[model samples]
Target chain A: MAEFYSLRVNGVDREVVDAQLGESLLFVLRERLGLLGTKGACEQGECGSCSVLVDGELVCACLVLAAAQSGRDIVSIEGIAPAGVSTDVQQAFVDAGAVQCGFCTPGLVMAAHSLLERIVDPTDTEIREELSGNICRCTGYGRLVEAVANVAKTRIALGGNRG
Target chain B: MTVSVPTSVAEAVSLLAAAPDSLVLAGGTDLMVEVNAGHRSLDRVIAVDRIEELRDWSISADRRSLTIGSGVPYSLVMDGPIAELVPALAQASRTVGSPQIRHVGTIGGNLGTCSPAGDTLPVLAALDAQIHLRSVSGGRTVSFSHFMTGVKRNSRQPDELITGVTLPVLPGWQGYSKVGVRNAMVIATASSCLAVDESTRSVRVALGSVGPVIIRCTDAEDWVVGQIDWERRAVDDGVVAEFGQRCGVAARPIDDHRSTAAYRRRAIEVLSARQLRRAFPNG
Candidate 1:
């Protein structure tokens, strides 16, 4: 018998079906929900390519079971920016040219969003530490660091305090 | 085909006792990794992350003991007042995977996994921490040393879940060091944790990844404790060399892809001496 679970994705209630016993949330989102923004790379949790926010906590989607996420709120990278509009972090990534191959961009952006949510004005060291789980083969992380730092500076200039 | 998310400790205990085969899930860091790698099979998972009762934490009335929730995240340990309580644990927590891993990984997860290379295992062993287990039957506490028996094996039964961990509010300096292939997001090739109790003038050291289970250097600990009066003698070239050799003898490493037994043996000496020196700066 197939099991179904209710999940809140991007503030919208959705019924996820055919959540097999061992199917990962990454597979369900990409295969079922068609949320391809959450890439599946290194299916092992080593690379943060499948990062997502489950109940406001960033976790490797590849490591989370779809069944385990029942009744939980999940935010994927696609939900962060809506209708051709990019978030400040995403904009910073573009301005800093942090995207190269772009395979790691979604995960990096999700991780950066999680970091910025907790820390409004993060230092260079803090940003690096927060995104250490994310592995990017291309661009060597310099622009990514600059991207997060740029958002931090912008938030501070806008009179926002670091959480 | 039962999935239970108990809101309280009592509820969780009751559910666990009802289904002894139920797999307890907290943080799901290690379990998820194994499941993803096809190393684990699970049909019944009991999520304990939301049970507020097990997440309770408090300092003992005497201020000499601290009881921390088993579900407390390592990131919390690295951030707040809890870090001050156990600096070695905080340092070890920093070595766990990375920020996201620490943010989600719980100390209970580390204890439940019972891996020798677990960043917090050696520190818990050096601190002589206690594991608090609870079931529908009742509650029982065991020493960390006795709780862990082998690699990834523990005395905890399927019907029981870890409630919390308790350790004496240490009254001295504690240090932890890990030698891994990389500084970030890497497992330890060999790790050592050393704690110096000035109140009792005792020193305890535990080594990880060099044995089937985390091993303590009783001889070196005793030697350092005995030489407290002779601080200069304790740090002497001969004493350091002897301590290192004894630590190496205590390890029983195996040749794996991460490293060879020979390399791990040598690393035990170097890391043990370094941690000991850091803990006993005067020596």
Candidate 2:
């Protein structure tokens, strides 16, 4: 068995079971750390359900090894809220009625949050492109796109704050 | 076995050379999928993401070529300095999977995976890109044509890790096109890339997912180049369509779940024609 290590998740340091050489980050998060907000859908990299932020870059946790994340800051959907109400992106999803079926909402929120981090004022096309990896079976992505765009606009209007 | 995350190129090379059975993992976009699907069997994995040396990218001092780090992500290739140097490659990179996949997937991973449907393979084949490989022993370069062996296979030794891909900086027009079920996050049914060199009065066309490896349509390229009267006439639609048909015929596709051989062949023809038109719009 490999030695366990301390990992920074959502700014909190927690010890996690050391991952085997090839164990995916998704498995470690869901199975080991019990961070269930990061869903595991289509273990294949196609679906964005396992999406997470590693050092601020959006990556498919299902496609990345847990060992590769050493010394990196990881942010999962569970980490999105430190206090209470969900992140602005999550709130926008509800306000825009973009949460349908809800399985893909966390992934969509994480993807949208990643986009907002890079571009506070993303165009509709950019938002669509960023969210392309995330699949929303119920909403058909019409409202999801709107939600992301709305969040981007709100972020910019608030001088880059969701508060 | 424990995974080794080497921080430098030398460390990575040493580790790989020491344990020839260790697998090199960059991006892990393809490898992880294979492993999770039980398609690949491996006992030891070496994570290459932390190797800063492999991530170094810069143009040669001569300014006659571009050296792209094997670890550079597809997103960087699509929007970074490499885009200006190799527009066709950038265009192809843009069509790989989606933004998330692009953010993590590396061109080196594409080469290492060596899939016939690799979006960037056709462009590299058409551009005659060179792959730089290194091991504890030393370094050597191989042409794109020689690097890939067959579907999901390559000639790279287990101990050798790709360091960079070098593409010559030349003045020419290039175009790439891929046919898939949908516009986003779909693998290529068939793809083609075309490069037209007005100075040499030559053209190069490479097709993917239509054969075991990216195939060059030398006969059709020569035929098109011979027929083009660059100064007097433009390349007509009929000529372009004929070129596309010839390029399509060069492919040997097989029926698969994603698409049928017939559909892939037909798509090859259309993609070939469209790419030629885009590469040589005036002709």
Candidate 3:
């Protein structure tokens, strides 16, 4: 059974037509909406390559049903930046050389943004725990952790709303 | 395939009664995996995640128990007042997948699945929690021991929805421990939770991934209670090793892909002993 539905992704309502009930939010975001930035690896929730923010809470998009998330506010990698500008967290990733294959960067960015939004100055343990879902097969966790911590310190110095 | 989103418990139950075969979708942490893996088919789905009634939690009038809504995610249990009330549950919550999974994964989802390896089941079993279920026909509460029937199976009827769980606020230390291949985002090879009740002067020990369902070690619990000095809140060093041995012997694990049966039994023993020692540090 295929039905039509609309999702508010990145503050815009996108219509999905004739989607199967089994279609996940990750599938719809990439294939239907042409939002290829949200990668889909290991379609199961284990990889965290499809991590996205649903209603401002981080979740693996692959685990969410597209139809069920119709009315929720979804923020993907494409929406993370403000008008084509990279946020401090994204810049920190570049400065720290956290990108290797660049496949897990979008999801990692989403996870980092979600963490910094809730905790302005998170500890190293907190950063590791929060980013645990987004696995960097490149094994760039040392620099990834550093990037997030640096951004956290920068956020505190800037005094709020910098994420 | 139709996805029905109900706003309240009444509507959800009515929808379930109308379509008993309707698959209930909460967090989709477990269900979507099966669907993605081509293990389960989805047609009519009743999405209850948005229902406000299922997301709210409250304390009893007497403050003797806390009733957490089935839809309350593990993140809520990992901190704040609920964590203060049930530290074992908080510890278990922290061990669940990661922050992303914890933000959406609910304790109700764990109960609804009833997998033998579910991280939260052992803690719920040790606490002697009561599961609340509702249907268009009526409502009833089942004890944790009776609720889980077998691996990935429960006593819940097709039309009945799990509403919440009520756990007593025991006046004692409680802790949870598990052994997995990795520290984070890894499923437990064997997990154990030990809760000590000062008022009853009794101990409750539960193990996961070591039996058909969450196993409560009645023999170990009774034996350990006798070894402990209730007044001094201590236990003899000689008795702790034997307690661990008893818990290991009680496990009914099998050789699975995740681990060997013998290793799971041994892990349960080690986890149980460590949890007991943590609960009674003076000993």
> Which candidate order results from sorting by TM-score in descending order?
3, 2, 1
Candidate 3 ranges with C-alpha deviation above 4 Å: A161-163
Best-fitting candidate, scored by DockQ: 3
Please provide, for model 3 over A1-163, each residue's C-alpha lDDT reduced to its tens digit, 9 standing for 90 to 100.
6679999999999999878878899999998899999999887787788999999999999999998988899999999877679989899999999988999999999999999889888889899989999889895699999999999888888787575
Clashing pairs in 3: none
Strongest candidate by lDDT: 3
Instruction: Give per-model CA RMSD.
Output: 2.1, 1.6, 1.1
- The most accurate candidate by TM-score is 3
TM-score of each: 0.95, 0.96, 0.98
Candidate 1 backbone overlaps, count: 0
Query: Model 1: runs farther than 4 Å from truth?
Result: A161-163, B229-234
DockQ of each: 0.57, 0.74, 0.82
lDDT of 1: 0.84
| CA shift of A121, model 2, Å | 2.2
**Model 3, range B1-283, lDDT digits (tens) per residue?**
8899998999999999999999999899999989888998898999889988888888888878999999999999999999998899999998998888899899999999999989999999999999999999899999999999999999999999999999998889998898998888889899999999898899999999999999999999998988887777777777788899999998999998999999998888788888778777767
The 10 consecutive residues of candidate 1 chain A with the worst lDDT sum are A154-163
Interface RMSD of 3: 0.9
